[model samples]
Target: MTTALDIQGLRKTYHNGFTALKGIDLQVEQGDFFALLGANGAGKSTTIGIVSSLVNKTAGKVNIFGYDLDTQREQAKAQIGLVPQEFNFNMFEPVVEIVVNQGGYYGIPRQEAFVRAETLLKQLGLWEKAREQARNLSGGMKRRLMIARSLIHQPRLLILDEPTAGVDIEIRRSMWEFLRKLNAEGTTIILTTHYLEEAESLCRNIGIIDKGELIENTGMKQLLNRLDTESYVFDLASPLEHLPATSSNLCHCTLLDPTTLEVAFHKEHYSLNQVFSFLNQQSITVQSMRNKTNRLEQLFLELVEGNKA
Candidate 1:
């Protein structure tokens, strides 16, 4: 499979002597939905900016779908669609006009751009607001508009930087579905987000940067499997007073509250069934249980902290 994006010895240093990238290398195969995650100032946005040609790279070879950024700049850029963290379009413009205008930058025929705009707007649930001024739409609608604009050219690769920020859960989930469909239709996507859970749910492969360096890059499932333990929170049907004791060192139980308990266990040594059995023995009844979504967050913290040290 061809690589959708490849970075070799990428480095970036600003005029203020602030280094944003530390010669980090990264790759994403064509058609893969990948996540580029990091805390603020970790160079995630810088890497993206360089790839999209919005920022000059200090030193590196960047190849997008076999087209070199420096030598084949236009071809490489033509393959990409970037949705930045902020809304950059004119708020006073009609929604359809805003989307179609983005296509003008790529030299797409105005008539064809209108057709593409219609299709994307309908797909993104923005058809009803197509004629409305952009500023009249809700925050989620504005985010969707950016996405529609990004895809106007139907580029092969799409880069999203915090695409769902500030969106309500319902709208965010809908956007997730739309993105999933886009990826399924063979558009390579690289997402950068502060929402760890969003990354965990949507991305197949992951790269985490910290302190201006890439600290971890691996398949999502593979990285998750490396985790030594998993934790779950269970709400009790009745009040429970104290931490529950476990027979094996593999299991650690803690009382989160009078009616909430948390259980941590080694994967090979314990299972949810065993936890249920143990609780049965204690005459404890569980009202509900949820897997703590912190598995990725936990590993992310470790890798980033390790990089710092």
Candidate 2:
């Protein structure tokens, strides 16, 4: 039940009088894998900047692991590791040096830093290129290097902003596995990504921000439960000239193709058993079935649109 991060009445305004955050409030529990989602200009980056001390907040409070950021800046910072959206490391520095040097900034001894650097580099698949300049590494390797650098100090809370933005699918999946392992080992993580599917798969709780306001903050399952209808695509064993008619008004059926059908229904009003019975009555055998859209994506869109209205 310990809190890893807490933000109260946080606000930020730029020089041009543009407010990036409007009395925002958030809390993250220890060991929780949380997702902070927003569209561009939604103040996600602004909030992160304030938390990391890159930008001064106009008003409010930020606490990291019970250390007040204002009174105990160093202690608060020592508990956070940030992997920004853009690569900010020295391009000319050797990959290993970049990571090892970060440890020094956190007061870690040189010898211990070297050992940690080697272990992280090897684990992230960057040991072979440890001596190479960071600029010489591929885009994916650069991203991995950033992650390795962020973890050099072994912070309790890690915040990743668009960590997989430019990585390929295979590399992205590998990073997902690595992050999952890190979370399982008790690191509280805050993830900001445009990939709704990634958030849905990896996070247990979600907070969605839009137009400098937090629109939704709740457990992932709770948000998903608000969705009354779910659409599914069913592949049939045999082709048909048309979709079979069903007497149940609770379900809406459509013919996607000769051998494919789409069924949408309210979760409370219908069940898979009803769908199966209807298909059996029409002599249609289902080969397979899958969701038409990701549950999280559907709810996210709904929340964003509701906020807009």
Candidate 3:
């Protein structure tokens, strides 16, 4: 597939001398759901700002569908839609007007814009609220309104920043389903969310940024594989003294009460069999056994902490 968004060596710095982004590189393939993950103050927003032309980059290159942002500004911007984290519309305006206005700004014809606006509002389950004042809508409804507004221009690539932040679980899941359908039909999506589970479930490619730097970028499966290793747990029969301070093989362990233990291990350096053998020799009876799947959250934490070091 072709690249929908290509960013090379992207960098941004604020006037107060705070570097918001540092030499970041990223690419979202056409029709792929790419997730950009990062903590607060990470460069996720700055990267989106540059791509959306909301902020001027101190240095770097951004291309939307091979159109250079600097040289083909209008064309590049035309192909992208950004639904920001915060609402940015007149509270008194009717929802329909706000959405139609976005289409107008993109130079879409009025009649066509009206049709598109209605279509999206209905598809996003907001057609009934289309005539309502923006300030009267609930948080989740406001988010859906933003999504509907962004699509009015028929953008090929949609940049969603914390899209489901304030939505209820049902609405959030519905939005995800809608986005998934959109991607199936042709839109390339770039999503940034604090919810790692959302990214892990929806995004095929993942990029993690921390402290102005891009720390990890790879397929979601590849990232999870990188974290696969030894797994063992202890079904303690009773409370005991302090456990080992650290272990070369044990990644970490937590005491889950007086009779339960959760242990994480690295398979390359240790084996569950060895753990079981040791426990057996110590006469610790196993009450049950369980295995945990490799999670993106664990890898995210490791990457962020390692970069800090």
Clashing pairs in 3: 230-267
Model 2 lDDT tens row, 113-154: 999999999999999999999999999999999999999999
Using TM-score as the yardstick, the better of models 2 and 3 is: 2
Per-residue lDDT of candidate 3, residues 128-179 (tens digit):
9889999999999999999999999989999999999978899999999999
| Candidate 1 lDDT score at position 110 | 99
Question: What is candidate 1's TM-score against the reference?
Answer: 0.96
Error of 2 at 8 (Å): 0.2
Sorted by TM-score (best first), the order is: 2, 1, 3
Poorest 10 consecutive residues of model 3 by lDDT? 240-249
Predictions: Cα RMSD each: 1.3, 1.1, 4.2
Residue 183 lDDT, candidate 2, scale 0-100: 99
Note the residue pairs that clash in candidate 1: none
Backbone clashes, candidate 2:
0
Q: Can you tell me which runs of candidate 3 are displaced by over 4 Å?
A: 230-294
lDDT of 1 by residue, 1-309 (tens): 999999999999999999999999999999999999999999999999999999999998999999999999999999999999998989999999999999999999999999999999999999999999999999999999999999999999999999999999999999999999999999999999988899999999999998888888999999988888989999999998767778888999888889999889999888789889999999999999998767889889888878878
Look at candidate 1 and tell me the lDDT of residue 121. 97
